[model samples]
Target: VQLMLVNLASPVGPPFALKTVTPSAFIQNMLQSTEERLNNTTEVNPPRILEWFDMSNTLHQKFSLIHMERPLFQPFPSELVFQNFTPLQTYKLPLILLNNDKVLRHVKLEQQESEDFFVVGPVNSGSKVAPGMSITFTVGFTPKENKDYEGRLICVTERERFEIPVRAIGPRAILDFRDEIFFPICLVKAFTQKTHLLRNIGNSQAKFKLHTQRPFSVKPSFGTLDVGESLQVTVSFHPLTVGDHREDLLLHYHTGEDVFISLCGSCEELDIHLEPECVTLKRTYIGLTNVHTVSLTNSSDTTLQYCWTMWPIQEVEEKNSVLLQEEKEEESKGQRLFECESSSTAAHHYSVQSGALQENGTTINCFYIFVVQKGEIWPNTTAQFSIVFKPEEAKIYQHTVYCDVTGRESNLPLTITGEGLGPELELSYSLMDMNNVFIGDKDQYDVQMSNVGFIEALFRFSVPDTTFGRCFSISPVEGVVPPGASQNVKVTFQSSNLGTFSEDLLLNVNGQPHPHTLTFRGCVIGPTFHFNVFELNFGDVAFGFPATLTCTLFNTSFVPMNFSLRVLGDGSGSQSVSSSSQVSNLSHKNWKGHAARVRPVEFTIIPAAGSVRAMSDVNIKVTLCSNTVKVYRLALVVDVEGGQTLQNLCDPALSSEAVSREGVSFLHSQASIDADSLRITLHLPDKEPHQSNS
Candidate 1:
């Protein structure tokens, strides 16, 4: 008898408050939603099951013992309780929900009425929790169509677990724990914690954390949207006492899961609001205009109380049509813009300041004063400045502005107006080259002056009257040319140090008056001198070969000379001669003492046509213009080629010691030429047939 009807009522707080008629919050929310559907129940083993691992350690696997489930027979509760059955409250037999052992499934039994609590401590703690009581043995079960089912059912009370003041409630809190109560599980955890046709489901945020631990307050609605936005949604549910007026309750908006719908009275009220975001302006004065907006969204999760009214209907169509921009190549001096206007009744203000819209519009935005000058026309870069509103020219009026573009902005309707004015008086000028007028080298050239225009043009700078005092020299000698950036005038020149160092072009960029003339160009700098002709001569020839000499190139330069020529020889048969007349790009040739300009020489003695000249023997040569020192010399005496001598000459052997066959005057050494000293004579005839030496 529910422990003697909770030991005759009389309980209160912290005993886990339950009394309210044994439904104890409906059996503590059905044992915590049946222990969250048995923790996502996952042992599903019916249509087939054998499992048994262990072949690990790469198969011959020794440490064996792998039953991995294969023997689970009903019973599986491990515990469940909702205490506080009255009697001054203090009942708690949930000893952590019958501590284990379950596989149960359809094992029905019935018989209530019987509690007789006699003695124990928690019969509301006033003591006496019945030392013995528990007659209704088994109670119920709803399992028949079992395919895998499982167990656990300990209904204790027989002898009520030891004497006086014990056995607090049925199952006597699991009668002293532990006893062979099978533990196999894996038949999808034996039908989700002991049989119930199993379709287990847990973790819905852990079952909404036990009703968010009972102290409520959450206001969430629905979301997502972005089509020309304009929304307001709110949804909140509360049945224990309403706060944000539960929007007519009846919500199953699962949208699918067996579908559901029924909301239109502006969604049952509660600050609904929806509709009011018309934005589609797509313009094109030459690109960019499609995504106009007015914005005000807040799709919901409970939170919306906006404020802003006025505008249920205000019209004025006609949005886009453009294709203009191209006409600013100079030649249009009719500019005007700078205005301000006003009216009486509640609104009106027209203003103008444009002029640079020409694909052929020719000076617009009338009623002028000085809109925009200096090469003029630039106005509309998407109309960076526009405030047009016209009316008092006779009647009607209305004008508005708060349009900054994407959509969803509320109140808008005040078309256009016209009347009060004020703002104009502009000017511009441009004349550059603060660095383009150059001509220097003692008599100088500096004409760098700038001021690219924007009002302030009045300049002066010249040197023409037959080029002033000859050549150039302009300073402030011709004033006033200002209006837009640029200034610098100094054109000096007087270096008559003549001949080959030139540069008289200082007319590069004179003051500008036609085609922005600030374009000066000229570069002249001279003086590098270091010329040649230290000495070289080619005169004295014919010895059957060898000879060449050249170097009369005096470069009193003004710069300009590049050369190359080298020829040295001592290898008999003589041969070595180079010419551009023997080297002379005239390293600077300014020859004043010789009237410069010497590029024409001749040196021909190229008569060494080979035949090995009897194995060669007769040399003297030198020719250098580049490999330095000595520009030319050749005395390659490779003679004996004309009319032959001694049949081609061959007599030159001197090995003393084999020179006497009988002589008288000692001291004979002959055969020389350029080693000087000659006078030879000897005659012998008398081989006993006439011998005579004289």
Candidate 2:
């Protein structure tokens, strides 16, 4: 404000004539002004500075009580003091103020009750003309009585009566607030005991997650911190690095927020008084399972006894049996606790590898064993645990298996529904349908699955075997059927060839495992094939001799045929019969078959040239007997002029031309032929005896 005023008064910022105020003088004046501003500044209202004090000790007759003024209410700084003898009694120390030598008001004092301490009152001490005073708080302790004396004066102030903090009462509070003030006492220290990296990790976790990075392997909190009562708590910390050692630690916790007690040093036997004397359950572990063991662990400097209680271990003695291994373990009257005390609270838990650990009547010792019922347990006799995830391991599934995991206690029926792979798939055809079908008829297949489980479930589907052609695929890759929905999955199939083909569809789903499967069966047939046979074996079809063979045909094609009867060989037989020399249409019989006896030709006939005949292609259709075929051909020999013949002919039905009475042996009557003209200019049965001359 003064700087602003100077600028306002001078316009050009500030005048060279106006000098800056002296820091000391300005401060003194400001103090006076602030004092007047406050309704009553406690700093000026008869400041009670500690001017004198005396202790009953001879080492320093100047039994002086030193009191300085500072911030009184807080999370104030705390302090502690150890004496050779336990103070038989405690006294109140006060610093008072006077008006005209008569008591006008008293400054405030700090006690262990508020939880922590601070400096207040006489805040602006020595500023006012007040007679200073100090009460010697005669802590009733002398050299003769031999014992230990302890006094913790957390914070200070004259008798101005105001709020303060709690401290000096114990080590826990110090560690809990170590980041700020140093408490006046030997506080909780920590370190690593065992060795190993994993265990050390436990400490690190317990540090940040449990206590503020302070190592209190054995976390101890007061039970009842009254005028004079002592309690000890032990803790165990597993060190994880393979090494031998010790590292000083500071454990921290608030006596206010999280827990109601403070932790003190275990260097000596200290008295503790925690409020709310007894609690419902001092300690408890509530999670997936029950308590395993309760062992006393003392990581402090002293040896002590502790007791513990286990969780809900009532009734079932068999389930609650505590097995003691390395040390002695026992169960006491349905109640459990810990008894032994040492420097570490980390108990050797045999129960971890054994069973349910029940606590024996105290916080000292404990025993444990595996309980009848285990956690994370399942009763799936069919559930498979191995997986062959790599492709190299895929084709050979010998390493893989089918499995179903059912809750042993749950007993839920499971069915698998799947696609890509079907189960029981490896299992043969579901049930077969025999009524058969028409070429283009629709058929339904009934695939059966018996749910071993009481409840119904979906069974995955797929085809692991049988075989599938491009003609098939399953629908609703996965289908959902409730328990016992032993329903059918109708598969529609079509046939291309005139025969029967079998195939399987796989189903999966009910957690039969990744590759779990089921079976779907189907058989498709070619138009319900009906005929003499699939094909006819005529031995070797020929010409004109009119070889006769009788066979029956079947009505299979589902169509009626008006097949006319004619004979041809690989043409040899027919060609030898005749080739008329006429451009005009030739007359022939509209012959048909009906069990009539057709007479054999007795005349020599021949084609002028370049003409073909075949009993083979002409013999193509089949009917009657079985949905099959049977053709007949006869060899007819004839003498004719030899000129050019068919080239590279391989048809079994076509016999070579012959001369005279000889059968043919020529692949080609060659001077060559069949520049693909069906007519051969000339051919003879075995080169005529006299050659062309004849």
lDDT of each: 0.23, 0.26
Worst 10 residues of 2 by lDDT: 400-409
lDDT of 1 by residue, 1-694 (tens): 3433332222212313332212122223333432243342322221112233333433332332222232221111112222212233332222111111122111111122324221122232221122122111221222222111222232221111111111211110000111111212111000101111111121111100001110111122222222223222222111111122112212111111111111111112222222232322222111111122233333433322221111111211111011111111121332321111111100100001121122221212221112221111122112112222221111222323222111122222222233322111111222222222111123455655554433333444443343212444567544443444456666664322221222222222222223223322233322111112222343333211334442222212222211112222322222222323223432213222222223212223222222222223222223322211222333222121111121122222322232222222111121112211111111112122113110
Q: How many pairs of residues collide in model 2?
A: 149
Give the residue spans of candidate 2 off by over 4 A.
1-443, 448-456, 464-470, 473-478, 497-504, 514-553, 557-694
How many collisions per candidate? 101, 149
TM-score of candidate 2 versus the correct structure, residues matched by position: 0.24
**lDDT per residue as tens, model 2, 179-258:** 11111222122122321111111101122112211222433322223322223333333322222323333232223323
